[model samples]
Target: MEPTRLNKYLVDAGVCSRREADRLMEEGRITVDGRRAVLGQKVTGNEKIFVDRKPVKKPESIERVYIAYHKPVGIICTSDPKAKDNIIEAVNYPDGRIFHIGRLDVASSGLILLTNDGDIVNAILRAEGQHEKEYIVKVDKDITDEMVTSLRNGVHIGDDRPTLPAKIMKMGARMFSITIVEGRNRQIRRMCEAVGLNVESLKRIRVMGIKLDDIPPGKWRFLTEQETSALKAALV
Candidate 1:
């Protein structure tokens, strides 16, 4: 068996992300063969490992799992409280605390991510970075050229700060597609409301490099291997 750093091994085992493993290492929360192990210490699988005094099982080399769900409107994004239309209940996924990479409001719907990898989840959702999310918005009134320009330039959405610059394209007389790198809560709705347009429907069509494609609302599918690799590459 090849020797590897304990922290790296722990991360690969899905015990924690690499950063969390490093933090635990610094806190002296790991041991190998009953000896306290340092952060960078190397070990082989034959040695016993414990995290927080509990033996760490040898993680099965199961393929990393990822899923994409086309959430329907009226479903909440949370798992707790067990609402009538919670995302978790809708999926009927097996018991595990899988989390969405980002959020969609209870009134909105579209592409949502479900993953077991904490590292991937953190990389995609970190708010300080730039990541474009595209949405198809239907408004109550016909959108004008000036409205499209205003959306692209940025507008005050009754927030303490102005909305970020965005890319907007006319889809129909009363519908448009908008892409914005910054995600604020109910941001698309608020921005449209600020410009005298009431959003009748909003659906996320893309997140960064991933598109919703033909996925139907209230349905989910496993990510193809290529899709998984592409997403991981985009994060880096």
Candidate 2:
């Protein structure tokens, strides 16, 4: 095999993303041929590579898997096996290792994407992609025009910058649907708090062009060919 960057190799081996691989290297958990690996190191795929003392296979051609899951509330969006409510254990995918594309807070439930192809992770999560994620949220109080206008305009949510303009539609007295391009930590909830409302429930309904549809909470399904193609195309 041709020489490849260590981080890329780890990603192709399904150990983790390039960013996570870098973290492992920094923590002195990655080694090559009994020597600690360094960031940006390259290998020809012929050397023994180990991550945290476990041997990693050379990058090989493998079938890629994409799945859409209706993540249930309380399931943590982390791949760490030690985490009590990790999403990976909840899915119990029998095929091979996979990681979530983005995160949904433990208090929220909804559509989340998972895949074995590490190459697409950054593409989907990059802010430059401006991929839209839609959610149905219920606040503790009645919806107000001022709140809707503020959300549609933009609201400061304790971030370095205010959130980008969002698409808002009041669904009922206390229920509304919102669409946002940026995914920040507890963003929707923080936005509500910034506007003097408390989020009672938040559920993502769509990610890009993929929808949760009828997938039962805690259950998952493979992405259709059409959905996969459209998603990749949007990343471009």
Compared with the true structure, all predictions reach lDDT values of 0.79, 0.88
How do the residues 1-236 of candidate 1 rate in per-residue lDDT, one tens digit apiece?
Answer: 68988876775565555565677778778888998888779878888998767676554653456888999999888644335777767876663435567789998889998776766866776643488889999999999888888889989987798888999989899989999998788889989988889999999988867789999988888888888998898888
RMSD of each: 5.9, 1.8
Name the best candidate (by lDDT).
Answer: 2
TM-score between model 1 and native: 0.73
Tens-place lDDT digits, model 2, residues 1-236: 77889998877877678887888899898899999999999999889988757787656855778899999999999876668999988999996677898899999999999987777886775644288899999999988899999999999999789999999999999999999988888989999999999998999999989999999999999999999999889888
Provide the lDDT at 198 for model 1.
96
For candidate 2, report its TM-score. 0.92
Most TM-score-accurate candidate: 2
Each candidate structure's TM-score, on Cα atoms with residue i matched to residue i, is 0.73, 0.92
User: Poorest 10 consecutive residues of model 2 by lDDT?
Assistant: 122-131
